[model samples]
Target: MSMRLQGRKAVVTGAASGIGAAVAARLAADGAQVFTADIQGEVDFVADLTGTDANTRLVAKANARMGGLDIVVPCAGISTFHPLEGHDDAYFQRVLDVNLIAVFRLVREAAAHLKAHGAGRIVTIGSTTSTYGDEGLCAYSASKHAVLGLTKSIAAELGPFGVTATCVQPGAIDTPMTAPAFDQMPEYRTFWEGKAPLRRLGKPEDIADVVAFLCSEDARFVSGHGLWVDGGAMVRH
Candidate 1:
């Protein structure tokens, strides 16, 4: 069996479902000691990441559970598909709080342990929306863009300490988070399919496989890269 991440410890935020859950499980399958945190009850740890103390405590627990931390993947975020004109201050702050600020705090807490290990990995969940914006999702696109920026900033800051950071940008993964839109507009699903040269919506596994590669030893030389796992959506057929 391939033990790419053997003996390493990983903490994944938003692990209760979707891409986060898939990443956590894949990492575990590859022999990393996985600590999956989410706001909901079903994950390994339940904590709202936006709260200062909660974010800290979750990281502390993860470090304790796995003996040490080597990898951190922040996957927590939200989306509201309203046009820019309809977006209000409160909505904007909420999106930023969960998608951007929480990731900052998670890294802040997890970095020390990762640095101690040297050759640490920090992977953030970004999106193709940051590259190609949809009309009704200005806020989401902005948040994802910031996430890519954050990933780069941290990569630059932590590289000297042997910690490398990268962002994975996914497109149209079939998850509960997208269930509402899929149900509301069948045409929307068709749009995603037609737009993708692969002629299919992304599965969580599709994104998870790339993430697993990023965290592996083979990726030690890569940093500050935004790897897109979008089923050829970013390209023309």
Candidate 2:
């Protein structure tokens, strides 16, 4: 690694496993001091994103641990495999709370610290579903779509402070979150593989690489953009 993020401080949510873990490790490898947060994991900060005060408290703790904040990646999310007819208010609300609302709260809470850094980066994890709807993922898709709006709004408001906010839309990455869908419908895996031009499912590191770039000084001019790291899956859509 080139240590592009040397001397930077970062906080990665859902850092116990999957894409979150990959991002945390990659940022650290790039020489950033990373503070990890997750509900269930041996992380630097443990808290449920659904809680009202979790985002605020988490940022405070990360700032204290790292002496400052430069990067924030809100990667915690949940999904339910229920069709619209079967979707209940509670289920729908839960998905939005974690995937969408939590991102909003985290960014809002960390904005001041990030703005103070003068080159702070906020990279959110969206999904291919952010642009295209998927069956049995009504709530999940809705939440992701909202994430784009949130990122752009933040970018607009924070740009003057030298803070950049962007979102990454990932395709079918081989992560624990999507394992159940793959297991239930083996063909789902094959379908995702062929959907992308690369003809293979994505890996967590794939998304992490893009994140690292966005956080680097080289990406200072790139803000309010939703970079699709989906192996051309959106083209097939």
What lDDT score belongs to each candidate, Candidate 1 first? Answer: 0.89, 0.93
Quote the positional error of residue 168 for candidate 2 in Å.
Answer: 0.3
Put down candidate 2 lDDT per residue, 114-202, tens digits, no spaces: 98999999999999888889999999999999998899999999999999999999999999999988999999999999999999999
Please provide the root mean square deviation of candidate 1 (C-alpha atoms, Å).
1.3
For model 1, residues 1-237, the per-residue Cα lDDT tens digits are 368999999999988888899999899899899998999958888988889787799888987788899999998888857878868988988888899999999999988998999989999999997667778887788889999999999999999999999999998888988879898988999998889999999999898888888999999999997988888988862
| Candidate 2 CA-lDDT value | 0.93
Error of 1 at 207 (Å): 0.7
- In TM-score terms, candidate 2 sits at 0.98
Top candidate when judged by TM-score against the true structure:
2
- For residue 188, give model 1's deviation from the true position in Å: 1.1
Return the TM-score for each candidate structure: 0.97, 0.98
